[model samples]
Target chain A: MSEDRIDIGGIADEYVLGLLDAIEARQVETDMESDPDLKAAIAASRDRFLPLDDTAEPTVIGDDLWTRIDAALPVQGAAPIDVSRLTANDNRPGGWRATALAAMAAAVILAVALSVNLMRTIEPLVVAVLVNEAGDIQAIVEDFGNEKAAVRLLADFTVPQGKTIEVWTLPSPERGPVSLGLIDDARSVRLDGPALPKPHDSQLYELTLEQAGGSPTGRPTGLILAKGFAKITR
Target chain B: MVTGAAPDDLTTALAACAKGDRTALRGIFDREAGRLVTIAERIVRRRDLAEEVVQESFIRIWTQAHQYQPDRGSARGWIYAIVRNRALNLLRDSKREYTVEDVELLRERDQVDHVMAAWHRLDRTSRLHDCLGALDDTKRRGILMAYIGGYSHGEIAGRLSIPLGTTKSWIRRGLSALRECMA
Candidate 1:
């Protein structure tokens, strides 16, 4: 990254052209503060195509588009979640609250190696976009609850690093994946049937290289540092 | 310093938004919805996905406006960044159809009206567009596709049908030239 080898001039061009590498783009961002010249260049290049932004024709979206969106919105005027009756204790957890709690429990298991592989002998199981590092989502973690996981994971573990595992119980492993939560690093973790089922019966629990924020995919589209089964807890 | 509203005006609006002012939020939305949608559509070509990206972007903006630190960047850049990042993710994560699909995208003849309207705005768009105009037509188009269409380097290359390396070089050099020119 020496100034000599790292050509700010070249990078600026690529960046404006939107063809710069991740590392190069990041470098430009860092250098921009001290390098006034670089900043000016970026602004100019950005302008070149700013107007083409609305290049697409005005899509005559069927009423359903807005209606669907409106319907999906958090009914802003819808009862306001009955806040009056909701005391700290009576706070009815949203559906996700339970899953988040379940994830925490799963995380705890990940921390301490107590494989629930045996649980697969029991009932069935279940499954956001995420970025790689550029702050964009790489994949999604599908949720499966009502379907009662139709799949199972049947594998043992042995990772190099105490890898953090994330289990994705996707509706269709063929499609995108869902992130249930994280598992402890280089350790064994199990999911129960009453628990979340892995996306496919042969769902994947992979160890990804993540910073604190976790992978954007909600699943590990990162280096498959290690992988194992979607076993159940007997 | 003199206009309908100063730069500070945008910041003030954001502050109000941060205070949970739904009205202020709407104002921000009203002002930027078209732009946001355009930006979102740029990144996520699919209209449905683009709309989703725009909606999510607004939700994030509403919730995260309080996190805005003008010192880092302007309210506008930060806002656009959110949508940009979201759109980028949508494009990369979800395998979208790269080619023109549906009659809507291919029915290009009619889109000229919309495109022209945007073009007229661009021609008149403040000092920024002037800076962009300084770039060569090819370089400008490449940059525009990226910024507006949300086309990745690869996509840009595909559309432009040029060597990937050349496209990358154009973007890099274009940015540098722009910064220099604008400065």
Candidate 2:
């Protein structure tokens, strides 16, 4: 390998080893976005030192700690929905109610389709109902074992002029978001999962409106239209 | 090292967590919280703050479970990495004033004798124990102090009475050697 590659790998090693100071660590994280090689090197280094995690002595924790953490979690059902409050005293005839009724009908059809699809697959599979801010299902991601996955859009979405929708996943917060690919159409699209890591439940799948081709910065650079967490269906 | 959740189990639980399964999150907490608390306490040196770190780290783990990649590393490592980073950030951000005596005490407590005792307790057949055994005392101790104790280069240098540059090189080279040996 070239000296330049070795140098990058060495720095990645230090970063993974926690030898880098805060400033250097932050720089590596920024570089990782625009630099795939750097990201791979860091991943390799992380794997190298993984065994070291065994060295820490197991300590007992206070019984209340788990409760405290559980209490602080964002309610899973906290998806943006204000229709309930609005429905309470709406004298207006069929305003939000009409839209909501249509949405619910769509959801029921999608659920039935999903259940049928789930029955056909023998392998352990995970799925995510990607929802917009208003809690409308925009897309559904079905991940089969290994790195194979498919994304199906549930609602009609027109990519704004001079823009395209891109898919991204957050594997871990520290690692930041990794681009999955650009969505060409809203129908069922096969995701290039092998190029990315395996999909895990609670993993987030999001669609962001980016420049026509994609985000030039390698990170999401536009408004996130929809996001949701994957869950195991098996 | 003895792990509560096997790698596959941890990975499965994390996946379930991503699916918003509180049961899966509870499973992980039940299995790993004790060890995580210990790891954080070692770095932060306070039980209460360490517990807080565990709390925050678990929440992150629950919220971000989908992000764990088996290809990158073991699920246990990924989980512990979050806890360690959170504790280290808290310690560094707070800029806790450590008296000279406290530093000396930590250094003394992390001496080779103590570290070796911990190392020997690990399964002797494990690759980590064998590879770590191959390193010279200074290199081994330097790496261990950084990972387990969360000691910065400056602190490691102070403890070892070595120049900062030498200490840095030792750790960097030590890790490189470990990578090669483990591979």
Candidate 3:
């Protein structure tokens, strides 16, 4: 890294200490990605200054704040299947029978509605939920057999005034993630599938906040707001 | 009194959060939300904006929990880093007018001194405490004002009535010395 000629340790310390200006901080972030030494220095400085956090007095959180945060979480089934909840299904008490029955009824109705309305044209073999850094489900991807994938937004997302959200995929075993395309909003869009391998189970799909148009480098060149792995349901 | 989860527990809770356990996240929130809000408030200087920063920080924590590597630092530190980064980003983006009346500026300096004194009382034994204690008042306050208050170099210089370059140099030198002393 060209920054090697500079004092990375001092820069990392200042960056972690929040002394760098916004523009300088952003530059450091960009540099850290390619400069392993700079990244390590940053990690070290973070640990060094960590104890100072103990100084702040705890300010009581408003009761409604958690409620707001909870509401923003990506709804279940929008991403990879949660592996932890999969086990211990048969051990629930008999009191859960009523809840189970109601859930099953709702699932059946929803399945029929989805098949009739959203999936009528293309059968989804694998579904992936793409979440932003906030864990908000920003988009959902349905892989129809072949290299084609249909992506739909789960929430109304406004592309920041001057920026666009770029989609990327890290196909299994690939050394680098490849760009899918640029999305303007939370609207359904078809990805014609880049020249990379077909989308497969366990592959990661991510949405990054990037400058308008897209990453000029043909790669993700911004903050990743959400990402999740593909899970084959069929 | 704010009682944090032990570093190990926080790490485990974050790991569980990465697994999509909402309750684990709530457990973390129940523990650190107050301290996080207070820190954000110190930086952003508005209760509502601080709350917004805390809310957004938790969401970022939940989504990026899987990316937290324990070997690098404490989970609590990682969480605070995210919160501080979010708060600072908001402060920078808002570009709020920084017109401080003379009286208001004096009041803020006193407030910072009060908080710094409180910190000294609570954390007397930490290596950072010792290293920071060793610095002169200007260097120490410059570093604290930047890290704790999220003041930019210009802001710190303005607050301290010093040249901007001097403020920057003091903070950089302070951090470098702190690192060396702690090491």
Candidate 4:
């Protein structure tokens, strides 16, 4: 917890006010992808300044504008893969319906565990039920929103001679996938990962098979053995 | 004239967008486009460019609707953020070609008037209106120009004919003060 300190100066305010230079502003956007406090600060500032936006007169949009926009929309019904909504009744293309049931069961167990442990432990900000390609529940990830996350493996993996199971999360598009930590013995452990924006609904979490130390690129380069989206804890 | 769509309706529309409902996107457009265009036009200063910004923003909204987290903030705020960022980016990339002296002499009046109009329009009873009333004139004006006009630090300083350092401090301090007063 000693490492929880952050010093972003007042850039959040400047960022929200549109005062930072272009480069600095972009940098702040990148920083917010991994810094929850900064994200929250900027969000707060944006909300506060929102009243100013309402002052503008609502001018009529050019009639052709919507036509242009309508023409440019992505092809309908080609919805992007949204694993967060994967459920036992999903009739979507992916044959995920089978394992989704197991995933739900795992989530039910997690919910009960969460309730039973409510008064005994720090509540998680989001919980994800990781599943293998076959839809078997593989692990559970509990992100604490303090740069710390817990990985509790429900299934064993044969970590070949020099390979290890690594935990990863997609904090934002700019940050890409970040390595949370490495699991060497298939044991439950809490990983003090690098700071990240507070987990949001549908944030991706996964486990990958990687070289012993970790991916060389600081990304998930190995085979993804399990993956799921974070369901924010109530 | 629409005081923005009701928050829950907008939220529901966004959810439907996530499910690939095009009509939902249209509903949002029908409800928010007029104001979104106006908001972007203030920052970009051109109707055509502002329309372009709003158009691009809608595409993004439709594609990324699933990413909106209901618990984090209001859906209307989220949509307005998309438009504002696009408008600001367009304004920044083209660099507006205005010399500091030209900006000060020619655009200062309009910018100040723009910001002042917004401040005056704030609901008389709202905390925002009262908190802003409490700020020093310079600080309040500096904050408003940056926010309403999307002026960068240099631009705000140039528009106000103040030292760049003074403009930065005023904005930073003004925002912090505004946060405290609102709190």
Give per-residue CA lDDT, model 1, range A1-234, as digits (tens). 546323655555465444544446556766876876666554544433433443433443333333333322332223644322222211211211223333434443442222233233443331222222112122222223433332222233343353344544333323334554554442333333234323343343333444344565454433433233333322
Candidate 3's iRMSD: 13.7
Candidate lDDT (C-alpha), each: 0.47, 0.68, 0.68, 0.72
After superposition of all CA atoms, the RMSD between model 1 and the true structure is 13.8
On a 0 to 1 TM-score scale, where does candidate 2 land against the true structure? 0.58
Better of 3 and 4 by lDDT: 4
Could you give candidate 2's per-residue lDDT for residues B1-183 as a string of tens digits? 456668899889888888889988889888888878877877766665577678767767775676566654678777887787777765664342233454345445545454455555656777777887899989888887777777788888987899999999998888778777876
Candidate 3 on B31-115: residue-level lDDT in tens? Answer: 9999888888787666655776787777667767777786546788788888888877766643421223422442364557644
Better of 3 and 4 by DockQ: 4
User: Which tens-of-lDDT digit does each residue in A147-211 have in candidate 4?
Assistant: 98888888888788988889998775434578899998878788999988898766778888777
Q: Which candidate is the best by DockQ?
A: 4
CAPRI class of candidate 1 = incorrect
Best by lDDT: 4
Clashes of each: 54, 5, 6, 0
Q: On a 0 to 100 scale, what is the lDDT of residue A166 in model 4?
A: 92
Report the C-alpha lDDT of model 2 over A120-149, residue by residue, as the tens digit: 654436666677644577887666646556
User: Per-residue alpha-carbon lDDT of model 4 for B1-183, expressed as tens digits?
Assistant: 124768899899999998888899999999889988988877876565577678768877886688777543678877898788777775654343223343344335465677778778877777788898899988888888878888878877876799999888787778778777876
Residues B1-183 of candidate 1 have per-residue lDDT tens digits of: 112224476678778766766666666665666656665664554454566566656655665566565553556655666666566654543332222332224323333344334545563555556766788877777766666544667766776789988987887777667656655
| DockQ leaderboard ranking | 4, 3, 2, 1
TM-score-based ranking, best first? Answer: 3, 4, 2, 1
